[model samples]
Target: MNFSSKLLQNAVEEFGRLPGVGKKTALRLVLHLLKQQDAEVARFTSSLNLLKEKIQYCKECYNISDEEVCEICLSVKRDKSTICVVEDTRDVMAIENTNQYQGVYHVLGGLISPMDGIGPSDLKIEGLIQRLRQGAVKEVILALSATMEGDTTIFYLYRKLKEFDVQVSTIARGIAFGGELEYVDEITLGRSILTRVPYERNVG
Candidate 1:
C-alpha cells in the first residue's frame, strides 16, 4: 500500500491521541478535515487552541474556568452553603445541565483506585477540607459515579469530612450501577439529588 502524504498521517496520529478515538476514526476525521476549506480548518484549529489557552482550573473548586474563579463559584445566586463533590469537570457540566442544583461544586480531578495507583492524596481533597473549614457550608453532596472506585472515593471523603460538623450526603444510587454521570438523563440526575441520603460513616 502506498501511504501518501505525511501531513494526513500526522493529523490522524494527533486525533488518535484523544481519548476513545481509534486509528480508523482518527483517519476518518483527518480525511474530513482535509476536505474542509483552509479557512474552516483554521477556525477549527484556533478554537481547539483557544480551549486550552482560555480555560484554567478555578482556584477554589478546581473546575475549569476562563478566569481565576469559575462562573458558578462567583455567582451570587448560587448557594455557597452547599457544595457538590464530583470526580471531574464533566460531572459538573452534567449536573449543571439538569439546572436543578443551586450550589457550587468541588472537582476531585479523579477517583480513588488502588489498582490504578490513584490515592486520596492524589485528588483535590485538601481544597475540599479547606472550604469546609472556612465554614458556612451546610451540606456537601457526593455526586460521584456508582463504580467501586467511586464508592471508595466517597468513603474516603466521608471519613475525612466527618469532623467538619456540616451535613454530608451522597447522591442516591438512582443512577444504574457503574453509570457515569455524563451519560445520565437530566431528570434522573435531579431525582438523585433530591433523594440524596446522609452519609453515615458507620454504614457501608
Candidate 2:
C-alpha cells in the first residue's frame, strides 16, 4: 500500500507493529480513527496513554493490574486454597471468561521456551514456590497452553513443586496440541479445567 503522506504511512506502520495486525488492517484502522471526531479520537488516544502509563503487574500473581495486586488476588470470594497457574495475563483473562474457575491465578508471564530463550528463571516460578511454602494452598492447577513450551514449563514446575505438600494438576487436553489457551472456546476451556488431570512426570 502506497501512501501519499509520510505522516499517514508512519501512523500506519506504528499501528502495524501491534501483534497480528497486518499493514492493510493497520491502514484501515488509522484511516478509521482519522475519520472519527477529534474528541472521540482524543478519548481513544488518551485511554491508550493511560494504559501505557498506569498499567501494573500484580505482585502476588504477576497478572496485569492497575494496582499492586489484581482484584482477583484480593477477592475474598475466590478460593484461597486453590491456584490456577497460567502462562500470562491473557491466559488469566481467558480462564476468567469461562467462569468455571473460582480459584485464584498465578501468571508465569511466559512459558519455558528454550527455542525462544525463555527459561524458568524468566518466569514467576519462585514466587509460586514461596506461595506454596505459605501452607495456605492445597492445590495448584497448571492451565498452560498445549504447545511444547507449555508442556516443558509444566514439567519443570511439576519437578519444583513435587516436594511441596500441594496437589499439582493440569487442565485436560480439550483443545488441540498446538492451541493456545486464549484461542480455545470458552466451553472447552471450562470443561478442561473442570476435568483436570494429575500432573504425571512420566507423560513426556
TM-score of each: 0.82, 0.82
**Between which residue pairs do clashes occur in model 2?**
none
Clashes of each: 0, 0
Where does model 2 exceed 4 Å of error? 174-204
The Cα local distance difference test for each model comes to 0.91, 0.91
Please write out the lDDT profile of model 1 over residues 60-106, one tens digit for every residue.
99998889999999999999999999999999989999999999999
Model 1 has an lDDT value of 0.91
Query: What are the per-model C-alpha RMSD values against the true structure?
Result: 7.1, 7.1
* Candidate 1 colliding pairs, count: 0
lDDT string, candidate 2, 1-204, tens digits: 779999999999999999999999999999999999999999999999999999999988989999999999999999989999998888988999988999999999899998889988999889999899999999999999877898899899999999999999998667677899999999789977886766683254
